[model samples]
Each structure stands twice: as structure tokens, then as C-alpha cells.
Target: QTDHYNLLKRSGRAKATTESEDKFLRVNSLRDRWLIEQQLQAQLNTGRSQQVSVSTVKRRLRAAGLTGRVTKKRLVWATKHRQWTTEDWKTVLWTDEIFGSSYRVFHSLQTWFVASTVSSLGL
Candidate 1:
């Protein structure tokens, strides 16, 4: 069974990268099964090979660990950018490459009032 799978993979029938025309071909965004099928067709439309079937495409994606999940973009917002200012400090959504999602809000400014000039006789 493993041998057969390997054969298919090598023959561009089990691996998504088999249709590598421009170095490598892959479906990045798999929003739906049908969409993925369409994408595979488009990717294999070089007219130099057999069209990959929906099941084959799906199997290849599974083999490659490409599941149907929206991969959120990770960003280190303040690392190279300015610190969050008071006017822009409302809410924050953060993520990292380590598969983490964090939501936070910060209030870094504080205000205080004091009677620095107290009247001697209740002015």
C-alpha cells in the first residue's frame, strides 16, 4: 500500500506539487471542497498532463496536512512600529506563529487632580 501511494505521488497523481509548472503548484486557500476542486483544475490546466480529480486533490492536500482552516496572519505589531498611542489604543487582536490568539486592550494613561494652591481662609 505504501509503495502504491509512493508511486502515485511520484507520478504526480498523489502529490499536489506534481503539477509544478512554475516551480511548485499548491492550493493555499481551501475555502470549500468545490473551490479546491476548481483550483486543482486550474492549476493542472497546463495542457501537458492529465487533470487531477477532486478526490485526488483532496487526498493530496490531506497527505500534505493542508486542512480546511483559515490560517490567521501573525504579526508583531509593536516590534518595529510605534507604541500604541492614546488615540489609537482602543482594542487589540494579536497572533503569533506559534498558533496563539490573544485579545487585549490597554489604558496606559492616568489622570489625577490635586489642590496645589489651597486657600488659607477658604478662598
Candidate 2:
């Protein structure tokens, strides 16, 4: 982040964090993906100007497993996209078990699990 900050500064494109061109334009699809991953209603509200359609934001959120409602514009998944098969759930569990205790040699397993899940999924 520091490196990218420096690059942005040198490139003369830097703006206030709230209204940075990077936030509005430079980030592109990845920004939408990230916003959906975050799923913060307030952040979504603030990120886009008032005139931006709610449907556009909802579209991105739905794609990123952040929304469940079906709208006439898009087909709804039979289930939320984040729902995994039993086998997939088992894999997620095993991965969590193996690494959950190792995040910090000091943090408790449960704490690490919550923190890691939140940080990794950007929830």
C-alpha cells in the first residue's frame, strides 16, 4: 500500500481519500468486487455518488455473494452463491482447522479463526 501510495503521489493523480479518482475510476471491476466482498451498506452508500443507481450496486453485491434478493434484471441462484456442497464445506473446515491455530503463534485458535475469516473474506 505504501508503494502504491507513493506511485499515486508521483503520478499526480492523488486526491482526497473520500473522492479520489482511484476510488471512482482507476479501480474498475476490482473495486466493485471488493465493495461486494465488504458488504457494508454505509460504505456502498458513500462510495458511489447519490445519482448512481442502486441496481448497479446490487448487481455487484449479488455477483459477490453479498445479496440474496432476486430482481427482474437478473436470475437468482437457487441458493446463495456462497453456499458450498458438503464436500466443499468439509474442505473449508479442514483448511481452517489446519491453519486456524497458526495465524499467530500467540493468538487463540478461536480468535484467529474469526479474525482470519473476517480479514480474508473482507467481511
Of the candidates shown, which would achieve the greatest TM-score relative to the real structure? Answer: 1
C-alpha lDDT of residue 79 in model 2 = 39
lDDT of 1: 0.42
| lDDT value, candidate 2, whole model | 0.36
Q: Provide backbone clash counts, one per model.
A: 0, 0
| Model 1 lDDT per residue over 1-123, tens place | 655643333433344345443222233333232244446556656574666566765555555445443221113344444676766654545454455332422222111112223463465
Once superposed on the true structure, which residue ranges of model 2 sit more than 4 Å away at CA? 1-50, 69-123
In model 2, state the lDDT of residue 57. 46
| Candidate 2: residue 74 Cα off by (Å) | 21
TM-score of each: 0.31, 0.20
Error of 1 at 118 (Å): 65
The TM-score of candidate 1 is 0.31
